[model samples]
Structures are given as C-alpha cells and as structure tokens.
Target chain A: MSSTEKHIVLAENLTVGYTPKVVSEKIDFQLNQGDLCAIVGVNGVGKSTLLRTLAGLQPKLSGSIQINDSNLESYASSKLAKELSVVLTEQPASKNLTVQELIALGRQPYTNWIGTLNEEDKKQVQESLTSFLLEDLQYSRCHELSDGQLQRVLIARAMAQNTPLILLDEPTTHLDLYHKVQILKLLQELAHRKQKTIMFTTHEIDLAIQLCDKILILDGAENPFGAPCELIEQKHFERLFPAEMVLFDAKTGSFKVNK
Target chain B: MGNLKPYRFSFILIFLVLGLAWLLNISLGSVAIPFKATFSILFGGQVDIESWNYIIWNYRIPKAFTAVLVGGGLSLSGLLMQTLFRNPLAGPFVLGISSGASLGAALLLMGASLITGFASFSFLNDFSLALAASIGSFLVLLVVMIVANRVKDTMALLIIGLMFGSITAAIVSVLAYFSSAENLQRFIFWSFGSVGNLSTQQVILLSIIVCVGVLLSIISIKRLNAFLLGENYAQSLGVSLKKSRLIIIIATGLLAGGITAFAGPIAFIGLAVPHLTRQIFDTMEHRILIPSVFLYGAILMLLCDTIAQLPNSANVLPINAITSLVGAPVVIWLLVRKRKMLF
Candidate 1:
C-alpha cells in the first residue's frame, strides 16, 4: 500500500451469514480511496452476504468494520449515509415516483423537514441525471422505465448521494450485455474521476477481470477471498466450476465451457 | 412557461372542488336550509328562527366538519401505511388497525354494561370506547413495527400484518357472540362506519387528534419518501428506521383510531384515495400526494355521505355500505388493470 493512500473501508476478522450458520469467517479486507473492486463468487458462495456485512446491513459475527478510521457502529446512520451510498438489486415499488423524484431521494440526508432540494442538491441531481444519460426520462415514472433504464436510475440516485464509498449488489443482473459494459465502464469512471471507492458483487467474472482494479474472489470450498491474479496463479479458478464441462484458461484469463 | 400553467390551473381546480364539496355538505341536509340562510347563519346574519340557527350551528356544522376531518385522517393514514409497508393494498384495514380499533369499540359497547353491573364501574362509555380503540390500534401498530424491524422483506411484513388483522377480527367476533342484545346492536352499528354519529364535542376532539396526526405526517414527508426505496435504502439515506416506523405507527394509530372511535370502522377511503391522488398528480412527492389525498378523500367521503342520505323511504344506508358501493369497484378495477403496479 502507498503511504499516501487512505483506507476508506477495512474489514477485520469479519464473519457474515444469516440465521443458524456462518457463510464465511475470519475475513480481513481493506478498500482504499478510489479503488474499484469486485467481489466474485459462484451462486450461494456469500458474495452478497459479504457486501451486506460491509455495508452494515447485517450484524457481523465477532468482527468489526471501520470506515474512514472510525468504527462502523459508531457512525450514526445518517452520518454514515453521508459517507457511503448503497444500491441493491431489488427494485423499489414506488411506481408513482418519477425518475427525478427517485433521484431526489438521494439528497434525503441533507434535506430539511419539507424535503426541498437546495441549489447544490439540485446541481448534483442534475449532474447525475446527465452522467447516467437519464435526462430524457427524468419525468418518466419508475414503473414505466425499462429494466436497464431503471438500473441506471438507481445508480444515478447513488451518484447523487455523492458519498465517498459506494456499494452495489449485482447491479448489472438485469442489464443486457451492452448496458452491463456501459455500467461497469461508468463505475470505473466514477472510481477514477470522482475518487469514489466502488465495491460491487458480480457473477460476471470475465467482465470483472477486465474492468476492476482489484478482484476479491470467494471460492466456496477453500479460501473465500483472494486477489484475482493470486487465485489465478494458484489455479484456484479451475476448481470453482465443475471439472467436466468448463476449464479455466489461464492464457485467455476466462472460463470456457466445453461444448 | 405557458404549458406549466395547466398544472397550476388543475391544482386550483381541485381546490375549488374541495371547497364546493365542503360548502354543499354544510348546506344540504334533512332540514333543507337555503344556501344564503346557511351562509348567513355561519357569518352571523339574520335567520328566520332560533331553531334554524341552533340546527345549523350546533348540528350540521359539527357533522360536516366531522366528515371532512375523518375523511382526511383516514386517507392520510392510508397513504402513510401504503408507503411505509411499500404495499398499495396495505392500509389501516389490511394491517389490522381498523380491526383492532373495532374490537376495542366492541369490548367497550358490549362488555361495559356487564362490568358496570358486577363491579359498579362503567368503563364502556363513548369516551372510554374511543380511548380503548386508540390503545388497541396503537398496540397493533407496535406489533407491526416490531415485525417490520425484524424482517427485512417487505412482503413478509405485509403478510404478518394481514395475519394480525385476522386475529383482531377473530377477537371482535368472539366479543360479538357474548354481548347483550342492545350492546350488540350498538357494536354492530359502530362496525358499519358512519361519519354522522359524532356529537359536537366528540367531533371537536376527533378533529384535534386528526389534525395533530396529519401535521406529524406532514413533517415526516422526507423520511416517508426515503422509505419508498425500502428500509435499508432509507437507512442509508440517514433516516432512523426505528424512529420513522414509530412516528408512522403513532400517526396512523391516532388517525385511524380516532376516526374509528366516532365513525365506526370507515373503509375504502384509505385504500382508494392514495391511488386516486397518484393518478391525478402523476407524481409521488408526498408534499403533493398528502394534500391531494386529503382533498380527494374529503370529497369522496362527502359524496358517499350524500348517497347514503338519498331518499330511501325508511332509513339511510350505512356509510360503509355506500362507500363500498363506490370504492370496491374502483379497487377491483385498479387491481385488475394494474395487477403488477402495486406492491
């Protein structure tokens, strides 16, 4: 790590899971400012669980998360909100809300009693809309937007929040290939240009490898987290998929299923 | 700039409709007073008889005001519940608050006389009944909030609320079975929901509670909108999930419980008014939706009250029954057409 680098998120000995059992344990991870990272895993390998733990959406088992050198638990929810923004995969059922209104919700942390958007908030919201190319649909209802469009709208909402750290869970799950690339590109741009530490969980390992600055691979059987290159050099990727159908091609840096 | 004029004009038009509805409600009644005479009576002008003044001032004004207050209160609570639960079908009735209130009222009406005979203490009077209903509804709200806090899934919370409502309804049914004949009549009448049953003092009390609740809800607009995304997202926006939930539950209890105490368990306004407001304004900003629903609900309740008072030879129809006649079909149509729109 560079001496000048500021660690925005640090997970020490973290254990994440739902009721009855733990998904993973003893996890230590650190995300520096402006780092674009991806958490990669197969289905049910606890990618989302890890993200939720980092985002403080779930209680950690015998561990601590520190954001910006402060204990995660110590930050009041609103203060934490001012520092971090989260975008989940589930769509909100606020059908009557227009795109602009939905985006305006990002300013909730800063709004007064009446929820009025001030000039600065308005500028940020407008910039988010422009960056997401959603200006055309700003007046459209969320229910009327396409799945890809809705996903962009949600991202715009998070961008409008203007937090230093952003966590997304399967943001491109509903997007087409073109939009998926577009979104990943946008996230990469956000991390570099806006100096945001972007962490997202995705099953698209190939795309993640090409775009992410660092990849945290969670192998269900063995070590849950390792740098993408470390895992690849260790030949851990081969065992992630079944041996018969798919093989990890180190040359191409991708998995190819035998047809 | 000129195109935006229509939006302003439509807003004013809706306001005018609400004003006209209020005026018509104040004027037209069984006594059939002229508009000018009613205005004069309201503004302290000459009236033919003291009885006319007394009827207009004491009876009609309070009754009309009760309708508006109860209407606005129920609809506001409905809007809040729908937004809080993220379910369009979720309202005071669906979440069991109305049932809880009804059970409390039934207990007061049915169990009071027996308790008074045995213990020489009367706890089933109207004021006591209103208090009991408020407590009962608030208790249900507390339970719902606890469940919502524990469960992250919105659909699961909705299911739990429905189950709670059914449980409260079962309790009310059991109370109905053991009640005396006269008490049963009173309980049954209260269950049908009427806006005209409030005495002047009762109207004043209900209005105060409803207005306070509405004001609290108004102040919670930002938090409520944040909640539109779901609890986690709302929390991420710095909203205190527990605090917001408590405020909503308390406000909902006050509005629904107060209305139920006096107007019985008024239905359909809470379920139908928010949807209508959403359709009219084409936006979900609570700043607009809250006030719009209030006006729309008031007009709807007044219109239903008018229909209930139609020239039925023997008696007026129950207000609940009349509202259902109008509201049920609209709800059914919304369900059919926008099957997936609602949560």
Candidate 2:
C-alpha cells in the first residue's frame, strides 16, 4: 500500500543470521513511521539476530534493508549512525558514571570530533532526562540506581539520539515485572508522541501484545507481523509456541501454563 | 557540570605530594646534599660545593625526570588497558608487552653474552639492552594486533596474551640457565630496574615518545569512557570498535614499550597507580582519571625510588622489588574491600 511505502524500515526478502548460518530467508516487513513493533518469540527463535541485522551491526544473510528509501548497506558508518540507534542487552562495565553523564553519551554521533556536547545537545539531554522522569536521579551514579532507573536512563539515551528508528535488544531483560511493563509503556508513549519507529526484541509476549502497535512473532520460517488484533484474529499467537503446558488466549492477549 | 570540589581537592593533594617527593628524591640520596644545597643546585643557584651541583643536576635530576615520565606513562597505559579489556587485574604486562621487552633484553643480556662471551659490557652503558627491549616489544605489539583482530572476547584475548608472555618468559629462563654467573648478575641488575639509567639525550627521546603516548591517551578518553560500559554499549553508542581498539593497542604499545625500553620493565606502578587514583578521585571518568593517574603515578614512583636509595647506604635496592612490595598490598586490600568488581 502507498501508506506502508513511507516506512522507516523497508526490508525486502531479508535473511538474517551469523556467518555461515542462515536462520530465516526471503522475509519481508515494512515498519512505517511511528510504529511501535515488538519481536516476540520463544527463546532462541532468532529475535535478537533479526534485531541486530536491522540495526546494521551484523550483515544481513540475504536481501536488502532500506531506511529512508536508501539501502542500509549503502550508508557510510557515520551517516548510518545518525539514522539508527540501538540499546543492547549486554551490561555496561560500571565505572560509577552519573545518570546525566551516561545519557549525554548518546550525543556522541552528533557531537564534533572531540565529542563536546554543544548547547542544543545539552538541552536535548536535559529534555530526555526530564521526559524520562530521571531528573532527580541524574546526579546519581549508575551503580546506586535501581535496575528500573538504569533501564530508564538507557531508554533516555536512545531518545536523546533522536534517531528515526530505535532498535532495542531485550530492554527489559533485568527488570522486575512491574518495571518491565513500565518500560514498555514508556517506549509506546515515546513512539506515538515523537513519531518515531521503535522495534525491540522481547520475551514479554503479553506486555508486547498490550503495548506494541504491531507484533512481529519470529516463528520458524514465518514473518508474522500486523496489528496486534489482526495477529490475534488470525490465531498466529496460538501457533507461537508448541509447548505442551503453555497456551495463548486470544481474549486476554496472554499466555497461561496448564498446571 | 558536577561540582569540582573533589577534583579540586585531589589536585592540590597530589601536587603537594608530588612536590614533596621531588624534594625528597633530590635532597636525601646516599650522599646527602643538604636541603638548601639541593634546592640551590636545582634552581641553578649557588651550592656549597661544585660536586654537590653535579650530583643534583647530573644524577638526581635525570633520575627524577625518568621517574616522572616512566611513572606517568605506565599508569596511563594501565588505565587504558584495564578499561579496554575491562579487567581489573589487567595491567601494562597483561598483554605480554613488557614480557616481550624482557624477552628481548634476556636474549641480549643472557643469550648473546653466553654465545659471544661479552656480558656486562658496561653497567651504565646499556645501549644493547635498550635496543633489544625496543625490538622485542615491537614484535609483541605486532603479534598482539594480529591476535586482537581474531578474538572478540576480552578474556580470550587476555589469556592468549598471557600464553605468549609465558612462552617468552620460558625462553628467558632457558637463556639464564646457560649464561655465566657474571652475565646473570648483569641481567639481574637490569631486571632490578633503575630510573637513573637514561642519559639526557635518552630522556629527551623518552619524553618525545611518552608525550605522543600521553597525547593519544587524552584523545581517546571519551571513547575509553564509553568503553567503560563494555564493547556492545560502546558500539551501540556509535563507537567504531575496530578503529578504537586499534588506536588503544597502538597507544598502549607506545607507552608501555617506551618505558620498558628505557626503564627496564618497572612493575606494579601501572597496576596499582590507576586503582589508587580511582579510589581517591571516586570517579571513573577518563578525563579526570588521566591527569590524576599521571600525577599520582609520578608521586608514587618518586617515593619508591627514594626508598630504593635507602637514604644513607650506598647500596640501593632494586625498584621492581619496592614497587611489588608496596603495590601488591593495596591491590589485595582493594579486592578484599570491593568484592564485587571485575573491571
């Protein structure tokens, strides 16, 4: 459709995996402006691989990924940096960095050669801090903050980057359930309010169903992505995991273990 | 900006200690020049005796100068390596860089002396030793850069480096076994590590190389700070990993290699000084840590060199022994206290 043509990400027959191993092939997806999408699947279903491929950290096994109508591989690294931002699952080597200091690092790509933050850059960082409700914790060292607070700071950094597309790998990996939902809801709010495309990989299926505008379920050889209700209507969520004890309920948009 | 109160306090304290250490190193050697005479001689003013002027200007000044550069350079490299590999125990030698230098020195000091029967050429004229050390460290740098590309994990890279160090050290031991007793003593004396070894021209060369290293370090601080959060986070923040890693490896090689070539592989100042600076400054920001470590390292090395002189005795102790003795305890204490750190 003409509507999907103005996408932030336009992937055509994209195949993704590490070198010498192809996980998925001939897959296509278009994530349009302001779309908050979640890639949900069981463990080892290549959710991370797909996110990484799209982030341009790893080479796409086969096919093309275009951002802003240009091929992903065609952009220079510095140019690609401004267009795409990523939040990783790996833990930082904490050296007692303050919340403000950590968030300001997001301006690195935009900053000059010496990495000095200009007046406008500082203002964006401040806005990100306030919007994330991290003004109070801005002076606190990362080690002193709770997991929830640190996760918020990471997301704030992503927001500060001001990229069109934000790729996060398991943003809620270490948080409590409440914090997990809190983070997801915040991201959902940002996607609509800022008119940015945000895609993240998560195992939090129910929360993804509730918060994401579109759900991308990474099943073997299938690229199921559509409006959450559409995926539920088509019974794609039910086909997600072939586990004996677990089941997906379309009415609740959640999973239950048959105990 | 965060309040500069801590930075201000540490700056004054480190500067004061550095001044005191400099005075101590100059004034109270085995031949005790009076404080006034040492001061006068240092300031290019009148001293009681001409010999006292020579002692202060020729011997102690160059010695103290060497200490400052060696200390400052090694500490900077240590902090860089520790952050790069994200391992606390990783030091200037963790990558076998210094070991590579020692290997070169060993081949010359022990091996060549055995084969050619020309050991202890002149204790003060260590031209061969310096050249051997430089060549050896450069080879290791090459090998390290090659291996660094192949391994992504820091732990794997460190282990590979340690293996290389072990191999080189074993070769040194083999050289030592076949060498004569006099050659062994000369080699041991070289291993003892002296700050007074460099002549003025050598110190000038050392300063030039170390200046380049320190400048490179300053340039890499922002990237290194990002790296404090690990490689993935750094990459996500748009840091070009391969490029940054290359710069770090080369910068470290220059810093560590230059010092070892001139200063005889001095130990533990690199390992311990960065930790001390971090603990004292209470911040891990590389911008602050670089200057802090440089000043603190100079102070500590000057202090150690003083102790090694033993003040009254003509017999000076080996510097490596003193550094290990003083440094090992602080590291142990830090580990015992923190209990929850790897980087």
Candidate 3:
C-alpha cells in the first residue's frame, strides 16, 4: 500500500438503504485519487444503495462518508456538483437532444445563469467528445445512437462535468462482452489520465478483477475492500454466491457453474 | 452554443410571419375594411370612414392583442409543462387550470341563477366572470402546487393533476344539468371560447400576467434544460427540484389560468403548438423554444381567429372549434409523415 497517497474517498462503517429498512451496514473503504474501483455483489446486496449514498442521491442511514476530507452532507448541492458527477441506469428523458447539446448540458455548473457555454466550457465538451470517441456522433440525436454509443455519450457527459470524483451505476449493462471491456478500459484510461477517482457498480466480477485498480466485494458482511490480488488471496469472491449454483474459481478469477 | 446560429434565420422568418399574421388578423374580419386602411390605421394614418375607425380601435385591435397574449401565453406554458413533466402530451391545461376556470365560469353563468332564483343577476358582468374564473384556477393551482411539494414522483403529480381535472369537470357538469335553458346557453357560449370580448383593461391586465409568467419562464430556462434529462439527473446538476418545480407550476398556472379566464378555455393551442414548433426548431433548448413557441402560437392564433370570423361574413364560428378542427388534422398529418413526434 502507498501510505503517502492522498485519499479522495473515505467511508467509515457506512450504513445505507431506504428509509424503513437497512440494506447493508458496517461497510468501510477508502480510495486514493485516480483509482478505478468496482463494487460487485449478488442481486439485492445493496450495491446500488451504497453508490447512491456516496453520490448524495440518498441519505445514508448511518455512519460517515467523507469526500476529500469533508462530510458528504457538508457541501451544498451546487458545491457538491463541482466535486462529483453521476451516471445512472435511467435513460435521458428526451432523446431529441443532439449528442453535442447533451454533453454541453454537463457544463451547467460553470456556465452562466442561462447556461450559455463559454469558450472554456466548449473546449471541455469538445475534449470529452473526442476522448470518448463520440465526435462522429456529436451532431446525431441521442435516439439515433446505438446502446454502446449512448453509454459512451453519457460517460462523456460526466467527463465534461469536470468533477474530481465520478460515480456510475452499471455503466456496462446491456452491452456485449467486447463492448463491456471497451467501456471498462476507457474508464480505466480516464481515471489514470485525468487523475479522477472513478467508481461503478457492476455484475461483471471477472472483468472487474481484470481491469479495476481496486475491488470492493459487497457480500452484505465483511464487505472486503482491497486490490484484486489481495481480494483473490483472501477468497472473497468464492463466497459471493451459493456453492450449488455457481462456484468462484480462484485460479482464473472467473466463476464456474457447479454440477 | 454554436448550434444556435443555424436557427437564427428561422427565428427572424417566424417573427416576420407573426407581424404579417397580426396584420391579417386585424384586417380580415366581418367588416370589409381594405388591407390598406387597416395598415394605415395601425400606423397612425386615417381612413375616410369614421365608424371603421371605431370598429378597428374599440373592437378589432383589442381582440388581436387578446389573441396574441392568449396564444403566446398558452404555448409558452405548454412548453414549460412539457419540459417539467417530460411528457410529450403535457400542456398548460394538464394540471386542470383550464378546467378549474371552466368550473368557475359555469358556476357564475348557471349555478348562480339556479341557487339564488334570480335568473342571472345583473352584477355578473364579463369582468366578474373573468374574476370568478381566475379565482377558481388559482385555487386549483394552489392545491396542485401543494401536492407537487409532497409528491416525489413527477408521474404521480401528473396523474393527480388529471384527477383534479376530472373532479372539476364532474362539478361543472352537475352545475350545467340543474340550470335553466337560458343559463345553459350562456354557459355554453362562454365555453365555446372567444378571443373577441376582452375589454382594453382586461387586455392590459392579461398582458401583465403573461409578462410575469414569461419572466418566470425565462428565469427557469437553465433548470428546464437540465430537466430534459429527468429529475434525478437535474437534481445532480444542482437544480433544486422542489423550488424549480414550484416556480414552473406557478408560471403555468398564471399563463393558463389568466388566459382561460379571459378567453374562456380555448383548446388545442396549448396542447399542440409546442409540438408544431418543434417541426422547425429541432433543438430542445428552451431559450430558443420559449420564443419560437410564442411566435408560432401567436401566428397560429391570428390565422385561426381570422378564419373563425370568415372574412367579410356576418357569421362567426366558435374559436375553439376552429382551433381544433384546423389544428388536429395538421398534427395528425405531421405525425404520420414524420413517423414520430420529435419529443
């Protein structure tokens, strides 16, 4: 571990869920700048709830979440917007917006009151489009893009937001294997190059192990957090699901169907 | 931002068309005033006919102004509702603002005579009717705004608004059934909707209300654009959801309610003008959309009013029928040809 590295995110015994019920609790994790992390768990294990809690989309039931050494709840919404951006599972309300217009919307925090994009804002949007390989589709309406292209556009929008931390919920859902790897690799590149702390929740355990700088295994308890090799050495993935259904193979960091 | 350049010419053309349409609306009414006379009168030049001046000043000009305010206000509120609710079908009347006004008008024209046994009291003038409708719509808006604060789901708020419309509509029908035939006819005339009867004072008041609403809409342009991505995303963009929602609701209420009170619930213009404007201005930016919708609606209203008066004829059709009859088919044809609504 790099003892001197600055931590961008720190959660101490975090508890998260809806108002009436607790989905998960006693969770602990810390991420340094430029780390690309994944939270993987079985269905209904509060993976999304934790991410939403961290994004300030929902209030945590208990425990503390600190972003850049400040309480997550301390920053005003407008101030928090400058610190983090989120990509969710829901599609945009209007598909009629062109790709360029949609990306420009991410600059809402820094733009004028009427949301007129200044030269700097325009430059960021252009850079995001180019880095996300979306320049060709910039003029096309969002409805015209394929699923992979739309996902890229969404992430690019978050990039244009120019926040220090980015959160995504299932950014690779509804994509084929090649596309999933492409997106994860792109996210990895974005975090390493831009020095942004990026985190996402996914069901792709194998890919997460392969590409993520850090892996958070949400098993409803013990909620192990560390590098992939450490997690594998600790046998956290083996306990992810019931042994009769699927077994985790530590040799290749992939799961196998038990017969 | 550079995308706005291509749409500049379209805006200028629409503005010119709005001017021409305003002129046409003022000129082509039941009386055969020549276009030259109309243009001269409009520019402070005089024609030889004295009564023509009276008709133009006292009757046609106020009606034209009312048409512009009603059409532009309704379309602007419709655009706001569509963006706020993120539903293509949402309009100014979706929150029952028009229906509330209708209930108020119905009570004034019919229920008062039935309840008091006075057979339409002398105190209930056009101004009083407008006041009653305005009060009713304000009450409904207050309730809807309260409900909007409590309900986190926008779809639920939309459904609740629909229920409010249904409840008000049921009450209006009950009022209609027990009233006398003369009272029923009075109520029917009010419901038929006209842009012709507003006085100069009422037009000035309406202009003020619409201006306030337009100002609120202008302030909301940034938040409205964020809302095109849905409420959660909008909130993440630092838009205060509850505050912006309330502001948008109040804006829609003032525009829709004030217009309905004066013009008596004209239909189709509020529901269809935004979609029609989208045919030309393809972007979803409200800065362009708000103005484009206002101009398109003003032009369409002028054209519709001109047709309802039927150009030099004594017969005048109901403006509501004219709007729907002329507009519904155009929307249908556009949707069919385009294979989808741009929303």
Q: Pick the candidate with the highest TM-score.
A: 3
lDDT of 3 by residue, B119-183 (tens): 75687887788888888887877876677657856677768778978987788789878888888
In candidate 3, which residue pairs clash? none
Which CAPRI tier for candidate 3?
Answer: medium
Tens digits of lDDT, candidate 2, A1-259: 3554468998888889888998776667788888899988778878899888888888998899999889998887777778888888866676477888888888877886656778879998999998899999988888888888888988898888889999999999888998998899889888999888999999898898889888888887667888899999999988887658788888998999966
Give the better candidate number (1 or 3) by DockQ.
Answer: 3
- Per-residue accuracy of model 3 over A97-137 as CA lDDT, tens digit each: 99999999999999888999988999999999999999889
Give lDDT tens digits, candidate 1, residues B1-343: 0012346776788879878887787677666678899899989999887787987777667777788888888999999999888888877877778877876776677666655644223555678878878887888778877787678776787687678777767876786677677778878888888777677678778879998899889888888888888888888888888888878878888998888878888878888888877767766778777888888888888878766766223366788998778878988888788775453
The CA lDDT of each predicted structure is 0.81, 0.83, 0.88
DockQ scores of the candidates: 0.54, 0.51, 0.71
Docking class of 1: medium
CA RMSD of all predictions: 2.9, 2.6, 2.1
TM-score of 3: 0.95
What lDDT score goes with residue A35 in model 3?
A: 98
Q: Mind giving the per-residue lDDT tens digits that candidate 2 earns over B195-304?
A: 88678888998898889888888888778877877777677667888888878877888888888988988888888899888888777777788999998899899999
For candidate 1, lDDT tens digit of each residue in A1-259? 5868999988887778986689977777788998899988788888899888778787777688999999988988889988899999878767667888889899888877777777888999999999899999998888888888888899999999999999999998978899999999999999998999999999888888778877777775454455567767888778778879988898778989877
Two-chain complex of model 1, DockQ on C-alpha atoms against the true structure: 0.54
Query: Which candidate has the top score in DockQ?
Result: 3
